[model samples]
Target: MVENEKDLKDLETEQSALSEEETSEQHDAPSEKNESSELEEALGKIASLEAKAEEYETKLLRVQADFENYKRRARMDAEAAQKYRAQSLVSEILPALDNFERALKVEAADEQTKSLLQGMEMVHRQLVSALKAEGVEEIETVGKPFDPQFHQAVMQAEEEGYEPNTVIEEFQKGYKLKDRVIRPSMVKVSQ
Candidate 1:
């Protein structure tokens, strides 16, 4: 009877040891589950941050392209202004230049003092040459096609030989600044 009781006590102790191991294992499983959930949350946050970074990169590239376009347009506008800067002043001086030329021609009757007239002529030519070099050209409408953009038809005439819409006379000279006409030529067109 004493040996049987001893064997039963040993069996109870072994059962208690196995129950303790199972309780500890249950506690470790919850900790592993918490670690896996935390790792998943961390990966989700990383992916969201990468997506935001990609959006910002696209916006930055668009802004850079817009700035470059603005700079190029500003440069072209400045160049065009510089090219036509002298247009207004030359138009204002043309009538005075014509008066000077007429006076020089009128004084040609005094043949003995021709040097003075010739000197004035040379100065006038220099002034005209300088204006021409800066892209100022006179619109030649006489005996050419009459264009509304460059010539103002003051009168229409029925001519025997000239074609219709052809300019037969230029009453007043016109001027152009490069491709742009500053003043339209006053002309007589044939119908």
Candidate 2:
């Protein structure tokens, strides 16, 4: 009876040890699975944050480029404004100059009138000089090629000793403020 009891107790001890090992292995497997899942979740979050950061960086670059372009355009506009500052005043003075020129072309009736006309001519010359200094210039029309940019053709005629589309006469003068045409020349073009 004593021998049988000893064998039974040994068997129970072995069974209990095996069960404990199995339980430990089960716990380790689940823990490992949990750790792997947590690691995968952390990696996914990191990837999402990196993508967001890249998107923000791209937007920032675009805004910076847009701001730079705006600044360049504003600077160019200011320069253009400064360059053409006297355009309005020059436009106003041109008609008066034309009237003065027409008055100078009239024949004087007496010596007193001729002397007065001479003085007027000198004043006109001085005014022309002042305008020249301010970058005001007259457009050439007669005998040159007719250009719509610089000349307005009021009449077209077929004339001798002139090429087709050539300027034959200037009825009214044109003026330019720098490179820009303030008024186009009135002209007769040969067809």
Candidate 3:
């Protein structure tokens, strides 16, 4: 009977020890699980923040590039304005110079007219040189193909050995300040 009582006590002690160990295991497992979940959440947040940072960097670079392009275009426009500033004044003076040339041709062999013609010629040459320095160029349309963008067709004629749609004649001269065609040439296009 004593032996049986001792066996019962030992069994109860063993059961209690096992229960304590199980309780400790349950507490440790929950803490580990919580720590792992927290680490995962922190990593996800960091990834999202990094993605947003990259997007902001790209947008900032694009804005900087657009600003640079705007500055460059404005600078080019200013330079062009300065270069072609004398275009209107020179174009207005062309008719007067043409009339002076006509006078010289009519008054040929007169000494007084010769001196006046020389002075007029020198003035005209100076004016042309000044315009050339300012980037004003004369459009060359004589004996070439007619282009509506650069030449205005005033008349058309059928001529021998001339291709159809070719420039037959130019009634009024055209001028260009630069890459842009300021005035189209008054020309006769061959049919």
Number of the top TM-score candidate: 1
Write down the RMSD of candidate 2 (Cα, Å): 24.6
User: Candidate 3: where are CA atoms >4 Å away?
Assistant: 1-66, 79-83, 87-109
Clashing residue pairs in all predictions, respectively, total 0, 0, 0
| Per-residue alpha-carbon lDDT of candidate 3 for residues 66-88, written as tens digits (9 for 90 to 100) | 66776798899998888778768
Model 1 misplacement above 4 A = 1-33, 102-107, 112-116
lDDT tens digits, residue span 1-191, model 1: 35445645765675576567547644643344577786775676568557656655764575566567767978999999999999889889889876886787664556766878888889988988898989888898878999999999999999978989999998877889899898888999999
Ranking by lDDT: 2, 1, 3
Selected candidate, larger lDDT, 1 vs 2: 2
Q: Write the per-residue lDDT of candidate 2 for residues 120-183, one digit (tens) a residue.
A: 9999999988988888899999999999999999999999999999999999999988899999
RMSD per candidate (Å) reads 25.1, 24.6, 24.3
Which structure is stronger by TM-score: 1 or 2? 1
Q: After superposition, how far is residue 150 of candidate 2 from its true place, in Å?
A: 1.5
TM-score of model number 2 = 0.69
Q: Using lDDT as the measure, name the better of candidate 2 and candidate 3.
A: 2
Q: What Cα-based lDDT does every candidate model obtain?
A: 0.79, 0.84, 0.72
